[model samples]
Target: MHRFNAYRIFEKEGQVSARLVELGIDDLDPGEVLIRNSHSSVNYKDALAATGTGRVVRRFPVIGGVDVAGVVVTSGDTRFWEGEAVLVTGYGMGVEHDGGYAEYSRVPADWVVPLPLEMSSADAMAIGTAGFTAALAIMRMEQNGLKPANGPVVVVGASGGVGSVAVDLLAGLGYEVTAISGKDDQHEYMRHLGASQVLSRHTLEMGKKPLEKTIWAGAVDPVGGEMLAWLTRTMKQDGTIASCGLAAGIELHTTVMPFILRGISLLGIDSVQCPMALRRSVWERLASDMRPRHLKEMTRTIHFEQLPETFDALLKGAVKGRVVVEIQA
Candidate 1:
């Protein structure tokens, strides 16, 4: 391709700015696979990187998207073939390297995952990095003895990308899901995604006791901060909490009583550098059993031109569900 549109962020003179510019293939980083990017997703990290509200981009003048799903146009590695559908996330993507907010993305073959047979390009991006992180969190919890029969699973920050997908996946797997969100208007929407009950964020503020009344069996926590601390205090014995995003805050002020006294497990989820085996497994499960029934309802599609406004909405917490960027459309 001679030229294609990409949203690039540049930091100069201590000011960060982003723009959609036309660039040639030479602008992309070196890699084994070249993808004719079809779709990308707006993640919290993507919002941070594009808006420069946070230090999400370690490199300047880089494309600003963390996830991409599309067709491989060429591949030097034998593991992937031309015309094969693939997806790439994490592993320095959209962080230290150029990423998917473009008409094309050239990435290492090792970073590319062949799209699951059951998933389409749009579907793959719909469940992009945010959904992948949620799936990883649930998978870790399951490995640590979390079962639907055990009890209800609470999803903190339940209206955002990661939290919404977590709620949908857990609910689809027959787990009674309780969604906690600050958005009062989204309570009904949360229930539609299979949450058996919806709780306001204020419900988590049950005082800063080292331990509290045990109510949940497992939790998919993307909110972090005090919400995680509260979940720690209120979890049943042997309960597991998957700590993912820090939408609320990063600091955790709590005692170790939950871990020491109750054998509570805190599984930190890092999707960026997750093992390839696990990454493939998670995507497969997402295409199969863990697939969200309400994916269409939980996602909103936008053209590449909408990224700036979308990022603003995401940063303001005004976006509901996942925001998929249609690169080809």
Candidate 2:
């Protein structure tokens, strides 16, 4: 049996640490299919898990990555065949279960999603969990009556992975996207992602009122905390906000005035446990009309060995866009 390299995380004495180790296939957690992983991408959650900055990993000595894309090397499940391209995200990965920061990943067939529309594994990982969550948010918001003609849509935390994808996706669909970012350096990058307007998080007034002047027709908010509360007060009548992350803080301080008076809706986006049918459909759309136009330009790849040194930038919110880890070739 051949051994492969994996970035494994361990928790001991209430402290977490990770390092690269060699492990044979038998050493990994058992699953129906074994994938020869080609690429994996860094999400904010991945950074948090590896750095022990967040309580994300539930199991000790688990591989550390939330998203992986590659070709099936072998499958005990009849649903998957060798050489088929697939990707897996969320659903206990990098948490209670071993994940994709390895040369190979073994996962339950149920969690596998076939690479949609002839997409390469690199492209799949480029989009990764972040892009999927963004697309899912847009899908949910549209079902709640959001559209290009519904007026402007604002994306909070617009320089991060999900936020960047949201800006590009919303703009590709014709919505006038206003990107909110704290980084002064990323305003031009935001504009390049199709943002009609870029708002400086440090300079913009969030305003103090139960209900502020109605501005956004819709909002893709991942920042939470005060930003989410601000979004609730400023949405147009019957507007929707898709809450995806808590990068700023989890606590939400908002009144029901917007919900009751303006008929605004707050839709929580749960990409981790999203239903399979919906997950597949959203990914199909992502490969089609909803794919980010600047995906290649917005992404950069690093060799697998570079993984350990890359998380600090993501944790510090310094990275501009997506970072794909090339595990093979």
Candidate 3:
């Protein structure tokens, strides 16, 4: 029972608080596989759970992180073995169980995926849950007949982790990308990620009609609320919009004209409980043809000690792109 460091969150008297502490393997929730965590990433969901901003944590005094990449220390399941590189995202990692904000993570073997070939632990964490969600959105869109030739794609909240990765992945796949963000400072960064157009959130007019003049052929909408309603109104016939996050607000107010007249598809991406088969397929695609071209540029690695403060910036929408935590280092 080796002692390792973990960041645990607690709820006391209707307040949420978290602090780093040391624990043995027996202290963690039971699982078949043990991972020596090398890297993890800070995502929006992780921020919410850690800070109690969204009340996502199901259990108190649990380690807080939704993404983990590491080497297998031991496994009861035959699918994995010692020294194998692996990663886990979603499937109740941070909320329902002790998570990756630790030097070691013991998780159900069914929840793990072998790290893709040629993908290092650092690279896997850089993608993490954010990139996985973005990729899942695109996967569904393509299944609905979305292609680069369909027309330009628009990504809302384009300066954040999922948005940045979506922009890069879409552009890499030859789709013209239009990025929309409120941060003027991020426009150039979006352009660098291969966006053909960057629209400021402040200047755009969200028309009030059930159906406005069609613009986008597809949309990666992480921001809900008014922005999502606008997309539903403005999508072209047969267009598909992948609704991933509710960062702007969860309430979507719109008419049925877009669905009836235009035949639009609103795909809800649930990365948390994604089927293990599709999850593995998506991870393979992420490491291969769909790999993000700007991962290094869009990501910065932070030491494990810097984890707690990163959540505040994330929740405030001040952080840009991805923040990978070097847990082992």
| Candidate 3 lDDT by residue in tens digits, 197-277 | 999999999978889999999999988999999999999999999999999999999999999999999999999999999
Worst 10 residues of 1 by lDDT: 201-210
Compute the lDDT for candidate 3. 0.94
Point out where model 2 deviates above 4 Å.
Answer: none
**lDDT tens per residue, model 1, 133-222:** 999999999999999898999998899999999999999998999999999999999999999999998654677689999999999988
Kindly report which residue stretches of model 3 are placed more than 4 angstroms away from their true locations once superposed.
Answer: none
lDDT of each: 0.92, 0.92, 0.94
Candidate 3 scores a C-alpha RMSD against the true structure in Å of 0.7
Best candidate, lDDT-wise? Answer: 3
RMSD of each: 0.9, 0.9, 0.7
Displacement of residue 43 (Cα, Å) in model 1 is 0.3
How high is the lDDT of residue 300 in model 3? 94
TM-score on alpha carbons, each prediction: 0.98, 0.98, 0.99
